[model samples]
Structures are given as structure tokens and as C-alpha cells.
Target: MQALVTVQHPAHVHFFRHAIGELEDRGHEVHVAALDKDVALSLLDAYDIDHTVLGTRSGSLVQVALSQATIEARLVQLARRLDPDVITAIGGLTAAHVGAALGIRSVVFTDTEHARLSNRLTFPFADEVWTPDCYWHDEGADHHRYPGFHELAYLHPDRFTPDPAVLERRGVDPDERFVVLRLTGWDAVHDIGDSGLDGLPGLVRQLESRGASVYVTAEGELPDALADRELTVEPSEIHHLLAYADLFVGESPTMATESAVLGTPAVYVHSQPLGYTDELADYGLLWGFHGDDRNARGAERALELLDAADTTDWDAHREQLLAAKVDTTDVVVERLLGDVGATGTARTATARADD
Candidate 1:
């Protein structure tokens, strides 16, 4: 099977990395087309994966709209050249729309509880819409609900193992209590802009008071006050650090989910409405809050959760994850092959599973 994977954000690169490799190992030829975001390109390089650059631009809604024509033309050309058996889009809407327009079978992975504006444009058009059970979006019974999150497919012990050498490379001491703080600059619906910095000082101070070393990373630049501990490592390496960290505090859901799957306690605060919080909170692994909730003392609250956290049930969570392990790459690849009437290649696809 020849496959083309489309990625919009850096997080989606990580999300599809293992899946792509798994597909290729099974004898499927996989090609990646992506916007040249700094983090996304960095991760692709770090992993030594070959991919074509679609284009580069600010990730604002306006930029997304403006780039549609260019992106579509590239997708059409790539599809003509690659002639993939299937196309899987990591970023939800854009990939779906382009893939569908080209008459290619496409799968979109989304975990949002509610539909974003993009979903309205793309979900109905996708060959398949894959979402975590926590996702509540439905497009007239077309969406397919998966039992797990993307974080689990990658972070589950069955698939991922953290390397402490990543920490060594970042000049972090293994003995130190590491706390990851993710600062977000993109908030379409809310003004979660630089004001997150206002709470950072207090949050950092509180964590420091507890003898925790705070490390920050952001989509945009961090404030001068928090730059001292800012993470400068490659994107893929950040995941390993989160795995080794004692706790994580971020406004990014992807990081929060990554931390939780790695057994790190996480508190994600942002003003945007979050749908996965309820499910993650139930797992006893994540805490969530709106950025504007002045009463919500995230740092103090994080410490309280950390202090009271009982890992007594972590084994159960791990067991649950293991039992539900769905090699997402394999699932999607098989489905794609099936869609293109490549059933005669079944024995070949199964052979790739050995990898």
C-alpha cells in the first residue's frame, strides 16, 4: 500500500510518527506532506524521516484560509505523483477537505469533544472520522468512535519507552523533580494571550517553594521572567522529558494527555472550553481549569493534587490501556487498504505487523 500522511501541527507529527513507521515496515510506501513549522520540521529531522514541505505560514485562521488554494494544489500534485492507496490526515479539517476533493480515501483523527469550525467543513467529507470516545462530535452517524486517545496509542508501554538519555541531552539532572509548564499563544475563541504569563510568576514561585524545578516550553516565546528554565530541546525529545517529569502544568491538551499517559501528573489551565478534561480527570491523571478562573489557583491546586496523588491505582490504569491496545497505525492501514480494494494484499499487510 502506498500512503500519504498530511500533518498540520507538530503534535500531529508525533501522533503519526509511529503509525507511519509501522505502515512502512509492513511494506506500505508512506510519504509525508506538511507545512514547515519549526517544531514539525525539527521532529521530522530528529527522527530522520523524509517528507516534502507543503508551505509555511503563521497558523492563524486567516493564514489557514489564505493557504487553502496552495495547499490543495500541492495535495493534488502529490496525490498524482504518489497515487497513494489511502491518505490519513493528522490535522483534522484541512487534510480531510483536500484529500476528499482529490477523490482519495482519507481518515481524520480528532479528539475534541465538540466540533471546531473546521470540523464542520471536513468531517462529513472524510472517508472516515476517527475520534476518541471522549469526543462528542457526531456528523449524522458518520463518525467512528475509538476507545482511546492518540496519546495512549503512542505513550502506552506496549509501544513507547522513555529514554533517560533525553534528559541528559537537555542538561537536566535525573535526581531533580521536574515540572513541565506549557505556555500557549494560539487561542481562537479566547484571549488566553500573554496573560498566562501573569499566572506563571505565581505558579513558578509556588512550585519552586515546593522544591520543584519548573521547565517551560511554548508555541511562541516565553516571557523574560520564565525564559531561564525554558526548554530548548527538539520536539520529539520533549515527550521523553515529560515522561520522566514529576508533574506537568500546561494550557495544551496534547501535552497534558502525553504527561498522563507517561504516568506524570498534569494540571492544564486555559480559558478555552475543554471536552477531554472529564475523561482524563476520571483517569486520576489530569486536572483542568479555565485561565480566567481567578479562584482557580492552578499551581497551589497542582501541588495539592500531587501531594494527595495515589499511584495505588496506576497499575489498573496501565492494565486498562494494555487491554485496549489498538495499534492505530495497523488499524488505519488495514482500513485504507480495504477501502482501495487491496484485500489481496492482506498477507503482505499482516507480515508488516511483525515490525
Candidate 2:
């Protein structure tokens, strides 16, 4: 099988990185078209996943639209030459457009129902829409729900193991009590009205007072107060830090979900509620603050957890979550290998070892 995968965000790279390798191992042709967004291209390089550049992601909705058009045009030309049997992506907008233009099957994998504009644009043209079972909406019969979160694709124990030496190598004690705080650049279409962490100085001070080393990772500019707190680790190494961290307080739902799946205490601050994040909260693996006072409420929750006497049993929660969910890479690779549709065996092969 020949597959074309489009990666728009850094998370998308993690989602497909393992699947790409697996497919190649089994005699498949895989091509990646990546957008120069944040650390996405850098991650592709670090993971040794060769890809063709598909323009850069820039500011403003208007610029984003124009860039999308240019990308779609380039994708059409590329698809004409490659003629991949299937095209897939996280949001799958450009892939859907180009697939429809070239009459190729486009498989869209998304867990975010709040991506209103992207979904409306991609779903109609996509041949298949793959979402987590926790996803809130139904896109009719074209939608296939799987029993796992997107983070499982790489973070699942079968594929990943936390490296504590990463901490000592970075000049930190392996057993040090540390917290990972993340901030996102709210430039995406869905994040227009949503908010992330505000008053970072105050929050950082409070986190420091909790007697843990603080690590801050942000997309855009950092406040002067947090300038010295920025984490200098590579994008790929963030997961290792997250796995060992005492707590994760972030505005990026992806990181929050990643932290939860890694059995770390997580607090997500966003005005919008995500089905997976909400479910993680239900499992007592994460706390989500999603109203107008999201920042203040989220900070309070983080502090309370840090100060709690009866601490959360993160390992137990993680084990419970693992018992119910599959390694999502199974689904991604199966779908790409033409083992999908109503008769797909991916759903039946949830046990990672079953493959």
C-alpha cells in the first residue's frame, strides 16, 4: 500500500510516527507532507521521518486560508505524481480537498469535535472519519469510533518507555519533584475565542512555592517573569519530562491528555471541553477548568492537588485507563493497510499484542 500522510501540528507527527515505521516494515510506501508549524518539522527530523515541506503555518485566519489554498494546490500536484492509494491527516482538511480533487480515498483521524470549521470542511469529502469513542459527536455512518485516545499511538507502553536518565542528563535529579507547565499559541481557528493560561507570573510563583522545580514550555513569547523558567529540552524529550514530572498544568489539551495517559497529575485550562479530557477527568487522571475563570480555577486545582495530603494514585488510574483502552496505533496502521470499513478487524484487535 502507498499512503500519503499530512502533518499540520507537532502532535500529528507523534500520532503517525510509529505507524509510518510499522507500515514501512511491512512493505508499504509512506510519504509525509509536513507544515512548518512550531516544532513539527524539527520533530520529523529528530524522528528520522523524511517528509516534503508543504508550506508554513502563519498568522491570521485570512493568511491561514490563503496558505491552505497554496498547500492544497501543491498537494494536488504531489498526489498526481505519487498517486497514493490513501491520504490521511489529523484535521484532514487539505488531504480531503486534494483527495476529492484527485479521486483518492482520504481517511481523517480526529478526536476534537470543537474543530468546527475544519470538520465541516473535511468530513463531507473524506472517505472515512476515525475518532475516539469518547468523541462527543456523530458524523453519520462515515465516522468510525475507536476505544482509545490519540495519545496512545505513541505513548502506549508497548511503544514507549519513560527514560529517567533524561532528567539527570539535563542537569536534574532523576527523583526531583518537578512540574511541567505548558502554554499554547492561540492562533488556530478553533482557539479564536478560547483562552489559555493567563497571569503566568503569579502561577509560576505559586508553583515554585509548592516546593517543586518548575519547567515552562510555551509556543510564542513568554512573559518576562517566566523567561528564566523556559524548558530547554528538545520537543521529543518533553514526553520524558512529562512522564517523570510530579504534575502537569497546561493550556494544551494534548499535553494534558498526554500527562494523564502517562499517569501524571494533569490540569487543563481551556474554555472549551474536550471529550477525551473530560473523560480523563472522570477517571480522576486529570482536572479541567473550562469556564470564563478557567485560569484562576485551574490554578486553584493545581495548587490543591500539589498541597493535598492524600495524593492521587496516578499509577492506579493509569492502569484502569489502560485496561479499557487500546493502543490507537493499531487502528491507524490497520486503516492505512486497507483493513477497515464495517468489517474492519482493528476494533477486535484492541490488545496491542494481538497483532
Candidate 3:
């Protein structure tokens, strides 16, 4: 089948890379369009996924709207030329818009309930809206709940295995115990009111006092006091690093969930409550805190986890978490290909248009 997939973030690349490869292996023609967000383009390059460059994200919401319009115009032209059987993306606004204009099926996969504006814009136009079962909000009949998260699409044991070589290359000693801390820029619309950890210098000192090496990753500028603590690993290898960390303390829910799924304990310190993060915490793989005192609470939780003699139970907890979730990529690929006929064209297009 001919498919067009749009990627907007670095995480989206990881979420869809495996599925794209699987589709190609099954005799499908796949085209990728990506915005220059963080390491998104670099990842597509690293994975050898050929793609077209969409517009980059602007700093302000008004500029973002202008950029989106430009991107949609470009996508309409591209879709007309490609005439894909189906279009798919994570929170894909352009896919939904262009697919509607072209009378093609658009499949949107999302896990963030707090992406209020994006969801409202994309859900009505999408043919199918797939989300994790743990997602907090309902998007009426179009929403299809699955038994897994976006992270599981690539991080599942069936799809991924952590590499020790990555650790050695990062100059981390094999026997060293370390913590991974992530700080996000809070530049997204949903993050407008949210705040990350404060007093990083104090936190690092506390983490080090517990005898654990600290590795930090940040989205925005790091505070001068914590600049020296930044992690220098390749963007693609960050997950491998997370898998071996003793603890993950972060305000970025994506990395926290990634670490939790990798059998490392994560302390999520943001104001918003995410369904996936809450669910992971329910399974005892993560801890979540919010409100004014969240930073303090998160710090305490990090210290508590660090002070423990062993976190081996995290592996057991991870197993239980995995048992309850399906491989999200398999689900996505099946949904995308199941209705497409053997001729590599969507048989349901006309029927869907009629409906």
C-alpha cells in the first residue's frame, strides 16, 4: 500500500520508524514528511528513512498558525502527487486536513490528552483516532482506545533491546550507578502554564550525595550551575542510556515514561497528570507529583528511590506493565494495512467517502 506518514517530533520518529520499516517489508511504498523538530530529521536520516521536509515550528502561536497553513498547502500538493492510499501521523493536523481534501483515509495516533488545541483541530477530520486505553479524555465515536502507549510502539521487548555498547561509548562505566534527569523547554501550547524542576544545582548535589552519577538532558537552556552536568550522548542512544539508569527524574513525561517502560523508576514532576504516566505509576513503575510543592515532592521521591539498596523489583514491575500492553506498532501497521487490498490501494476509500 502507498502511505504518507508525518513526523513532528523526535519521539514521533521513534514511534513510527519500526512500523514504517515493517510496512515496506510487506511490499508497501511509504513516504515520510517531517518538520524540523529537535532531532527528528536526524533520526530519519540515522534510520535511512527518505522524507520530505515540512515547515519548522515557530516560537509563537501566531507564527505557528502561519507555519501550519504553509505546511498544509505544501502537504496538499504532495498528497495530490503521491495520492496515497492512507495518511498517518502523531497528532497530525496536516494529514487530517489534506486527507479530507483528497478523500483519503487519515489515521491519527495520539496519547496526550492535554494537547487540547491539536486534538480539537485533528479529531473531527481524521477517519480514525487511535489512543492508549489509559488516555483520560474521550473524543466521541472516532476515538479508538488501545491497550498500549505510543512508547510501547518502539520500546517493547519484541521491538527493542538495550545496548550495553552505547553505555561504554558514552563513557559511562559498566558498573556505575547513574540517574537520568530530563528538563523540557515548556514551549508547547499545552506546556504554557506548566513548570519544570527548580534549583537544579541543589538537586544534582543531592543526587550525587547518594553515590549515584548524574546525567542530565535538557530541552531549553540549562541553568549555569547545572551546565556541567549535561549528558552528551547521541540523541538516538538516549533510550539505551535510560534503560540502564538507576533512576529517572524528569519533568518531561515522554522521557519519564520511556525510562519507566525500560524498567527504570521515573519521578514525573509536572503539574499536568497524563493518563499513561498515571497508569505506569499505578503499576508501581513511576511516581507523579503536581501543584506548587511538586518539585519538592519529586526531589524526595528521587532521593528515596536512590537510597534504596536495590531497584531490581523494577524489572519485575516492568514485566507486569508489558504483559498488560500490546505492541502498539503491530496494532498501527495492522490498522493501516488491513483494509488496503492486495493491489496496494485502499478498498474502503470510496465506501468511506460515501459514508
lDDT of each: 0.70, 0.88, 0.86
lDDT of model 3, residue 257: 94
> Pick by lDDT: which candidate is best?
2
Error of 1 at 78 (Å): 1.4
TM-score of each: 0.86, 0.95, 0.94
Local accuracy of candidate 1 as per-residue lDDT tens digits, 1-355? 7888887778778778887887778788889988776578877887888999888655566776777768778878888888876788754565677677778778777776443566677777787776665665455555665456777656767678888888998899866777888877664322424243256777788877777788888888877888898888777778789887878888777888788777777787765545566677777777777656632577667888556544345546645654644445444555655642254333332333222
For residues 88-121, could you state the per-residue lDDT of candidate 2 as single tens digits? 9998999998999899999999989899999999
**C-alpha lDDT (0 to 100) for residue 107 of candidate 2:** 92
Off by over 4 Å in 1: 187-197, 309-327, 339-355
Tens digit of lDDT per residue, candidate 3, span 1-355? 8999999899999999999999999899999999998888999999999999987976788988989899999888898999999999999788998999899899998888888988899999999887788888878777777778889989999998998899998788756889988988787777777786888889899999999989888877788888888888777899899998999999999999999999899999998988999999988889999999998899998999988738358888999998877787877787687543333212232223223
- Model 3: residues with Cα > 4 Å off, grouped in runs: 309-312, 339-355
Clashing pairs in 2: none
lDDT of 3: 0.86
